[model samples]
Target: MNEGDERALKVAVLGCGAVGSQVVRLLTEQRDDLAARVGAPVELVGVAVRRLDAPREVDVPAGLLTTDATELVSRGDVDVVVEVIGGIEPARSLILAALDNGASVVTANKALLAEDGPTLFEAAAKAERDLYYEAAVAGAIPILRPLRESLAGDRVTRVLGIVNGTTNFILDRMDTSGAGFSEALEEAQELGYAEADPTADVEGFDAAAKAAILASLAFHSRVTASDVHREGISEVTAADVASARDMGSVVKLLAICELRPGPDGQDQVAARVHPAMIPRSHPLASVHEAYNAVFVESEAAGQLMFYGPGAGGAPTASAVLGDLVTVARNRLDGTRGAGESAYADRAVQPMGETRTRYHVAIDVDDRAGVLAAVANAFADHDVSIQTVRQEGRGADAQLVVVSHSAPDSALSATVEQLREMDIVREVTSVMRVEGDAE
Candidate 1:
């Protein structure tokens, strides 16, 4: 090893929870290998935790554990700071301080990045330091780097996939076991796949944050969590899942980011997170249980799929270590990797104006002209139906209609009109259809 490689590079860790514990374990077990890869001995200088007396998963040296996170990052000798403390306030402040103190950062805080990434990027740029967060979006999956580097030259038209494992597990249970939303959620919680509150994952907030990060990277725009249109799987019923199965499809919570034309004919981005029906043949439909998958479509690379364990202590730590090694290498070389690239600065398209397809199921009177009246409702909104199926149960009937690609506003208007019709008893289900040609 060269003289510079002989010197140790110091690392500070914030938060000693699930991901942080696994990260510390990896750093200790693979210290020699990491040193050979980065051309410098990677050192764990300190670990900042909430309490020094708290029980930990890994055997952290008592001397290295400190509660003063602010002071740990502020230390001038620290060369890199690993932050797994999620949320907005302290994580954000510490990251900024680390960059300003001339230390590169590796983080797994998706909410922080999606909420206010520009602030961190600007700090890194001003300090000439690297801010790498590969563990943010999809746990161990190597999706972000590909979007930022491998596919940099190609024009990405769409990125649609499942980003949250908790939500996916619940939805998959509902499909495979024919259980309702509550039953599936109960199972997920029992298996430790979901939290007691599960609000962030079940209600789509987790996926929405990931979607914002994906849109910003794929489109080179500054997309935030507030910009994503989010809907959860809480309202998904067994009837909806059966409806999808009837059409040879399955329901999955999806984060979709696409480049569409704006009112001015310029390309704009639309990012949304919701439960959608995809054909059984689609690669994403096979992602079961707690696994996650992403499908990317570009001008040159027709279709690419990334699948793996989306969340876990060890899986997430793997991504964190990957970024740590890269940043360490850059530090030894006296250089920095690429920073945020928002040069495109494109506008975000409104959800109402976005074009998509819908699957609607209605309970109507089994009488003449009922189908005609329902067809007229769609016509009033200028929405055309692609396929229609009818089933009779003597006094009443059920109608299933799938519409072609149309403005979301128009599809919603048609559903509202059908609900008010005298012959229509109820609109049983309404869901968007994806993974098919428009």
Candidate 2:
């Protein structure tokens, strides 16, 4: 240490798992480079863990590992805390303590943020400290920073993305190899693309959390995970993939957030995560395997895409390190960086009220009046048909109807009415369509 230089910024790590291990490694390996970038030396003081003897992907120095995370955050001397311990409870409590104790925080906890971000943001603002989570949404793709900083001045209309790598990997396999959902999921698990319990990713909870964060950032509103309408890829069958193929598109689980006009002539926000069919030519359609991509639309920037590896140890760790540098630099400068922006406070419109398009496949009797009854049902519900194609043998025919954009309530009602009618045999599949003209 030089006598003439200011004291180095002390930082701490919470959790030494996959991403955390990589973070520790980078802090040790790239100490000088990070110090140069932040205009001050960034030192790792401690790593909080559940068990000291638990096997780790990377080795932790003997003196740094501790089981009590609460003590580390409230130590009064730490300048920044990097949290990779996901979930609520300890993570949230520790973060609040760190901020209240005058320490900046950089985390990758999407669940805590999506469920309760305003509280944390308010706490950080009260303490005049920065809380940055660049790794929360899309791994190393740099989506949140661009949305929060670069497009801060501009109005963002929409954000459509493939945010979950596990779902994307499963869907990509189903689309390419014509595999069933079970078959594709097994392959994903064997290839380490999915966890032993992949419920969060497959059931759309993970993406829904990310979508909530994206919506909150893009629209400047407070959107929670409950506000998002979620649908898993578990129900996405092989027939759905074939149906998408017939339309020159591919099936993908999408996290979509849009700034839409409300009935009162005010702009409202709608966020959702579901399996959708997007055109093959779309930028996100090409994001195959365990990769992530976000497509942003703004008034000034027009269109922009951020793509990269969405998860795993190294890619996610790199994002955590980037945030650590930014926060550390802000600490040295005696200035605070930007926090959450919920000034607009726009309404998060319900899924039933949101306007969307759908591709409906129906199996009906080949007899006369079947097509007429279906068309009349849609007309009764005020849903206009964009295209209609039918194929099958006598007494076992099918009709594929793609409808123009309409309120979800009306379209759903139309499908329900069709289900009750004698002429309609069964509603085989009803999937949303995105990345196309409405």
lDDT of 2 at 209: 97
lDDT of 2 at 318: 93
Q: What's the lDDT for residue 175 in model 1? A: 92
lDDT tens readout by residue for model 2, 58-162: 888889999989999999999999999999988999999999998999999999999999999999999999999999998988999999999999999999999
Error of 2 at 58 (Å): 0.9
How good is model 2 by TM-score?
A: 0.98
Whole-model lDDT per candidate? 0.95, 0.93
> Which portions of model 1 miss their true places by more than 4 Å?
1-3
- Model 2: how far is 294 from its true place, Å? 0.4
TM-score of each: 0.98, 0.98
What global local distance difference test value does model 2 have?
0.93
Give the distance in Å from residue 236's predicted Cα in candidate 2 to where it truly belongs.
Answer: 0.4
Q: Tens-digit lDDT track for model 1 on 51-95?
A: 999998999999999999999999998999999999998999999
